[model samples]
Target: MERLFGLDMQLIADTLLTAISVFVLFTLASYLFFDTVRDVLKKRQDRIKSDLDTASKEKSDALCYKAEYESKLRDADKEVEEILSAARKKALQNESKIIDEAKEEAARIIARANGEIELEKKRARDEMKKEMIQIATLMAGKVVAASIDEKAQNLLIEETLNEMGDETWLS
Candidate 1:
């Protein structure tokens, strides 16, 4: 090759230097790409960790809410048991009172019946005694009025004189 432009050596040297600079630039660009990719991956990991932390917190909150609900349910159950116990006691008391009242009423009715029966018996006995006395007095008066004095005197005195002569006939 002849020096046609009188710059043949300088052109060849400049072409070599341009080739080296392009190679260095390509290497530096590849390194920058790798570093940026690493940074993006780290950021993704941090984001994922934050998301996991939030999930754990939510789970704990849910557990707390469930525990609170269970506690409230237990309290409500205890209250219900107490209410039932009170209701049962009240019902028993009412039943006892009702039974006592019924017994009292029964006793009163029996006492009243006994008193009425006694009164009836007394009235009947008094009426019977009064009737008996009246009948006895009437019979005694009739008997005495029919059986006394004049008849007795005539029969005794007249019959004795007549019977004195009849002694001969008797022999």
Candidate 2:
């Protein structure tokens, strides 16, 4: 037993042997399992990176789709406005056409009424002229047959009007 620095030689030898054993064990574990752990970590990192890329692509696609949808919505709105405007214009045209037709119909009706009025007036005048001619013929025959002074002529005219009656003159 050598005792230098108040430590036993046997204890020092045992401690050194334990340290070497631990070092050897650690070295063997590193050699066997380090590559597998590194490979697993690398695969995990690759998977995470791939997932991130896929997520980013999906996000970009979603943004594009959103933009396209918005554009389409705006186009649809514009189309609707155009359709509405066209409809309004058509409606106004129809209104104007209807008004014009109504005006023309009114004018035709007024013209027809005026023509009928003129025809009625002409007919009434012709009837009056016929009645007047018959009355004049009767008076002439009476005058030629009788030698009439003013008083007799007046009496004859009065008699003739009485015979004709009020109803004849009114008609």
Candidate 3:
């Protein structure tokens, strides 16, 4: 044995041998567990990817539902407007019909009033004519009592004819 750095040569040889054995054991342990550790990590990564894909699909589905609901709301709004417009048009037509009916009724009433007025005027004229005839007959009787001769009767008659004028022919 050679004495180097005042340490025993046999002790150095034993230490080196122990270090080599530990290194070999460590390498064998790593080789045995590496596949198991890698499999666990790979399974965890696959589960995370699946979860992310599911979440993305759910988000897209929610967006599609929101769009569909918005479209229905818009269609409902248009339908409401159309119904209201149609109701307004019907109301206007009803108003016009009522106005026309009122006007027609007023016209009928006015025509009836005019007819009554004309009828009343005719009745008054007829009554006046009857009174005038009675008065003329009384005057003729008085005249006949005062004069009995043919010449006097003829003179009275001629005077009565001249007073009547063209009014007799009009009646």
Candidate achieving the largest TM-score: 2
- Candidate 3: tens digits of C-alpha lDDT, residues 1-171: 665666678879988999999988878877888777889899999999999999999999999999999999999999999999999999999999999999999999999999998887777667656665665566667777876676766676667656765465344
Worst 10 residues of 2 by lDDT: 162-171
TM-scores for all candidates? 0.53, 0.61, 0.52
Which scores greater on TM-score, model 2 or model 3? 2
* Model 3: ten consecutive residues of lowest lDDT: 162-171
Q: Candidate 1 — which residues are off by over 4 angstroms?
A: 1-50, 133-171
Q: Candidate 1 lDDT (Cα, whole model)?
A: 0.78
lDDT of 2 by residue, 1-171 (tens): 665666778989999999999999888888888888989999999999999999999999999999999999999999999999999999999999999999999999999999998887778767865776677567756775676676776677677767766666554
Off by over 4 Å in 3: 1-55, 140-171
Give, for candidate 1, the lowest lDDT window spanning 10 residues.
162-171
Candidate 1 structure, TM-score to reference: 0.53
Candidate 2 positional error at 160, Å: 9.7
Question: What are the lDDT scores of the predictions, listed in order?
Answer: 0.78, 0.85, 0.81
Clashing residue pair totals per candidate (backbone < 3 A)? 0, 0, 0
